[model samples]
Target chain A: MIRLQNVSKIYKPNTGALSNVSLHIKAGEFVSIVGQSGSGKTTFAKLLFAEERPTKGEVIIGDWDISRIRQSEIPILRRQIGIVFQDYKLLPRKTVEENVAFALEVAGAGPSRIKKIVPQVLKIVGLSDKLGRYPRQLSGGEQQRVSIARSLVHTPKILVADEPTGNLDTIHSMEIIELLKRINEYGTTVVLVSHDRDIVNALKKRVITLHDGEIASDIERGKYMI
Target chain B: MSFFLSALRIIRFAFQNFFRNFWLSVITMSVFVLTLITVNALIFINVLGSATVQSVQEKVEVSIYFEPDTSDDIVKSAQGYLLGLSQVRNVTFVSAEDALVAFKEHHQNDAVILDSLEEIDGNPFGSALVISAWSPDDFTFILEAIETPEYQRYIKKKDFTDYEAVISKIQNLSDRIRIGGLVLAGFFILIAILIIFNTIRVATYVHRDEIGIMKLVGANDWFVRGPFLLEAIMYSAASTAIMVGIVFLSMRWLEPWVSTYFGGIDFSAQQFFLDNALLIFGSQFLVLSVLGLFTTMFAIRRYLRV
Candidate 1:
């Protein structure tokens, strides 16, 4: 349900972040975008979310083209895509419940809906008991789960977890990947972008590799074959 | 979202942000209070100076003594004539008998002066007209108005008190206060802007990750920017409230001291502030909020891009 046609991203002074990339994935696919550092994987993920506009080509989702989405429309696009960062981007001062509820709050969800959905998501991430704790009081795994819970508030069609387990231990990383797999199974498109070979191989799902801003390979039931 | 719900949430977030950064808020408010104090104190001094000038003007008058052989009826007619002019605010007829009593009272403290006053068999004092004018400058017009040929023939001396030095000093002080108040207020406003700007920048920097995460979680532009804008307003309101309290207390304490130092010139900053409470506080709140909001918006623009 997502496609990029000859997308290229170049920064100032002739620095090409992603060059001449063409890719597509069907709906309901659990896909992994894998590449080493400076291989344009992050830029590719940014392109999908319109965080960085491509220097050339188009990014289309379903029937809508967002290659040059207007600034005012970015928030609407973002509301449809759930994005998780490497650092587990939770507000430090907010408690677990407040942080999760904040997502619905920003979406203009009513207090009753926020109260109802936040607990459900937090329960799914298995952090219902820790709702009163702030981000600083949570373990790395718990914090990441809060971020995931927040991203799920809108029930977005596509969830992009960019290095979702980048800061976690092996056990924590596996747990996060399992959570993503479960989320994908529920029919939401999951695009997991990471360089971790072990995590990629463990999935045995569709994998797309990027080599210096170009898509090097794509395979169903692929391993971490860089 | 309904506007009311959104507003309530925004206000809640603003208050949360305020208290969460209590020390920073305090410092920001302290700087704001100092700025307000400078402005209010300047207003108070300006008022006091004007009142002092008015009080001094009231004490100044010209006394016109009639010729020794001049009839009492002429002096009374001169009084009536001086009183008719719009420039003259007041005119009192000091009869010969009244002048004699005043001279005796003046020399009562000195035996030699008393003996000389007694040596004069009859009352040596002449009937006079004491005239106070609307302004020091109007004294000239009032004195000129009474110098008609018919009136001048019976006049022996006309004395306007030597208050040139006092009026000149007051004029210089007034000019200095106006210019100095403007210059000082301008300088303080500049400093307040810089400090508030830097404070907002630092506050935004502290919340940079929060903003990024909020946007990532699908917050609209207003959702993300509302708390900061509202926080700016809260800062202005809180500081203004504190300043109002401080101003009231200080004015109350300083009123008696000012009255004593200026010979009871009715130096009442408290009264002045109370009379114009809405104007003074309303304008202060408006200026401070505008400054705060501007700084906050400028500081957050770079972060809101994501």
Candidate 2:
């Protein structure tokens, strides 16, 4: 369950990245935020992670008021919500398994828990056979999968994929989207931000379009609409 | 996890990361070893020099020349008086006849000096009273001992005029040794910090992706910064151990040389070892560990802040 009511984010004095935007999605929903560049799509996701707070109004994820979250509590909030980016921010020096284990390590997961869960997450993303490979050794698609696996280590209640497939070829992009679909099916709420019209049209999921820092459309089982 | 467990995990990760960049780590540590060794050598030389000076000062006996016609009985009374003073370790009487004989023996190699001395009719050398003090600080008290009325009348024109100035110069040299030791230690510390900072910066650059990944994975500030701090600390600690070893070995090797050149000094290498080696090592460990900790922490803070 996620809710944003009249959320406004002004970065500096006059740079209103997001202005008076209100949106909500139910638990287990897979929602895509579609927009052109500078249309507040990334800002919306950043707010969800408490990376940036809404300058006005409330952001409620499940039961927490993230807008008022303290700095020390940000990690807990992040653990509850997984974020994946187009950059595939996998630690290049670490193998796929180490990168996933690193996430668990930071979350203070026990070695036994890490040993048990890292393999399962990697397996889920079909990276089990490539666990020993570094990020550079893997293809772009596989590196993103490792990122996805790392995100799943916490079994976060919400998985936010911000342009997750932006750097992939069409086939790789579809594989990534399908992976997200599988994760959503496992009952994790998913928020996808993208400008890929083909992928958006193919998903046929709930879509919210942003134009000039305002929501232009919200459609159930929406198509890609400009 | 428990605190120990967390620390152990950090250490493990740090070591793993270190080996991953094994060549770089070795290069960094070698730099540390080289710099620390130089610093240690400077401190060693500085300490050894002062100790030598202190020993020399201890033996710097004050010579009191008697009047040309002073009798041996009066000189004997003067020796007795000087021997009673607490500052005087011992007093040796050099009679005029004995002084002339000793001078002749010392100059026997020089025909011109021997021939000139023989040309004088009577023994021209004055009877000398030599007073050895316990230390340089005791020289002032020893001077007062010789100025007694019985000996004062026997004082000749050749009484040591520059005794106080020379003693003070020796004392000043001792003080400089102490101050120089501190400055040298501090200078090496600054250099060590700069070396570690640059080393960690290189490491951070190599692992920039790891840092970014940690940040994205919901790792907090400590999680992101811990490994770099640990790595820097590891190098510092290792370098400290090596430096201590080098210092000890050098001291051992140089001890014989020092004893050979200036064994009569009280604060010889052996005496200094008996006095301050453990204390020096303990304090060096403490100071170096603290310096290493702060330097690594600072480097990590500046470069690895998420």
Candidate 3:
């Protein structure tokens, strides 16, 4: 579960990335944060992981006051939360399996455990056959799948996919959305941040729309609405 | 993970970084070898130059020529007095007749000089004492000691042997070589730092995306910085090893040439390096590794925030 109360973020010189925002999501919920380019959606997601702290309010994740988290504690929080970027940030020199194993390695997982879990997660992402391939050798969809597999290696409580399908074709996009749905069915809280109308409309899930740094609407089984 | 496991992983990742950027490794190591070469060359020159200067100073001696009528006993007594001083290495007394014979031998190639020497004078040369000292610095004292009133009246001409200019020139040249070598070595040290810095920076840039991903995946700060520091040490170590090989090989190869060219005054560079191998190599390794670590630390500070 994640909660943000009266969160306001100011860059500098009167530039507000997010202002007066309060939101909450229950455990095991698949929530989509919908916004335009500068609607504070990315900033809101960053706050969940303490990548950027709130300038003026509380950010609580499962009773942890992440708003005042120390620098040393950030890595632990990150291990508990899986974040996927638009570019699918994989180590270029690492093979697909090595890339997936890296997450467990950072988490101090032993070699035998890493060897065991890596293939299982890669199987979940349906890329077990391409474990030996580099990132450059894989397609955009496969690369994104590797990123998803890495995020799942830690079995994080929350998975935030910021534009997971932004660079994919329609078929791959739907595939990624289905993967998110499958991940949600396994009880991990999912925060999907995107503005792709078709994907948001098709999901018909809980959607929170942001306009000018404030939440414009929040609906149960919401549609994509400006 | 256990501390041992963590150390193992760090070393593994360092090797990965080292081999992944193999060319960068070679460049870094090559640059390091160059810097060491500069330092070793300076050492060799210092050894050779000291020997050459000492040999030149030994060849320089002042000759005190007494009056033509000065007795052999007196000249030999003066020689004995000169030899008694600890500063004096040796003193040889030449009689007037013997001096004339040596004069004829010196001009033996010139018939006119030889004929003139036979016809004009019975013995134009005086008894002279040739005095050598333990060091060129002792020349002043030895010459002044012989200028006492007991020996001054009998002294006809004192060839002061003005080799100060030569010795000063040699000293100035040696100082200049050392100073210049240091300056050059300093320049190379700077280059080595920059190259190592740039090597780390480039490695950071190459892994910039991986760094972000590692942070996102929850890597601790030291976990991210450890391999980099290790890689720097590896570069320093490998380069130092290669430099040691080059130094050992070159000195061994040139030992004969060194003996041939600088034949006297008792100096051997190869022996010096061999005797102080640990001190020389250990200090070099320590300095280079510390330099590398500092550069790596500085270069990684900007990237560790992720």
Models 1 onward score TM values of 0.95, 0.84, 0.87
Spell out the clash pairs found in candidate 1. none
Better model by DockQ, 1 or 2? Answer: 1
lDDT of 1 by residue, B209-267 (tens): 88988877777778889999998888889889999999999999998888888985855
Tens digit of lDDT per residue, candidate 2, span B1-306? 455666777787888888887887888778777876776676668777876886778667888888879998998888898788777788899999889889888888999988887788778877888878878687677777677776788888434456778888888988888888888778877776677556656656767666656766777777677767777767777877787677667778877887788766554454564477667655655565565566556555543333
Question: Across residues B130-218, which tens digit of lDDT does each residue of candidate 3 receive?
Answer: 98888767878888888788888899987765676765676677677678767876876677667656765665666666676678788
| Residue pairs with backbone overlap in model 2 | none
- Model 2, position B17, has a per-residue lDDT of 81
Identify the superior model by TM-score, candidate 1 or candidate 2. Answer: 1
Interface RMSD of each: 1.2, 1.8, 1.2
Candidate 1 lDDT (Cα, 0 to 1): 0.86
What would the TM-score be for candidate 3 when compared with the true structure?
0.87
TM-score of 2: 0.84
Query: Which stretches in model 3 have alpha-carbon errors above 4 Å?
Result: B30-55, B65-104, B116-135, B148-157, B178-195, B245-281
Q: B127, model 3: CA deviation in Å?
A: 6.0
Task: Rate residue A169 of model 1 by lDDT.
Answer: 97
Which of candidates 1 and 3 is the stronger one according to DockQ? 1
User: Which candidate number would show the highest TM-score if scored against the true structure?
Assistant: 1
Q: Candidate 2 DockQ score?
A: 0.56
True contacts kept of each: 0.70, 0.59, 0.73
Write model 3 residue lDDT over A38-122, tens digit each, in one string.
Answer: 9998998888878889889999999898998898999999989988878898988788998888788777889999989999999
Candidate 2 C-alpha lDDT tens digits along A1-226: 9999999989887898888999889999999999999999999998998878899999999989888888778878888888899999877667889988988887788889999999999999998899888888999999999999989988988999999999999999999999999999999999999999999999999999998889999999998788
Ranked candidates, highest DockQ first = 1, 3, 2
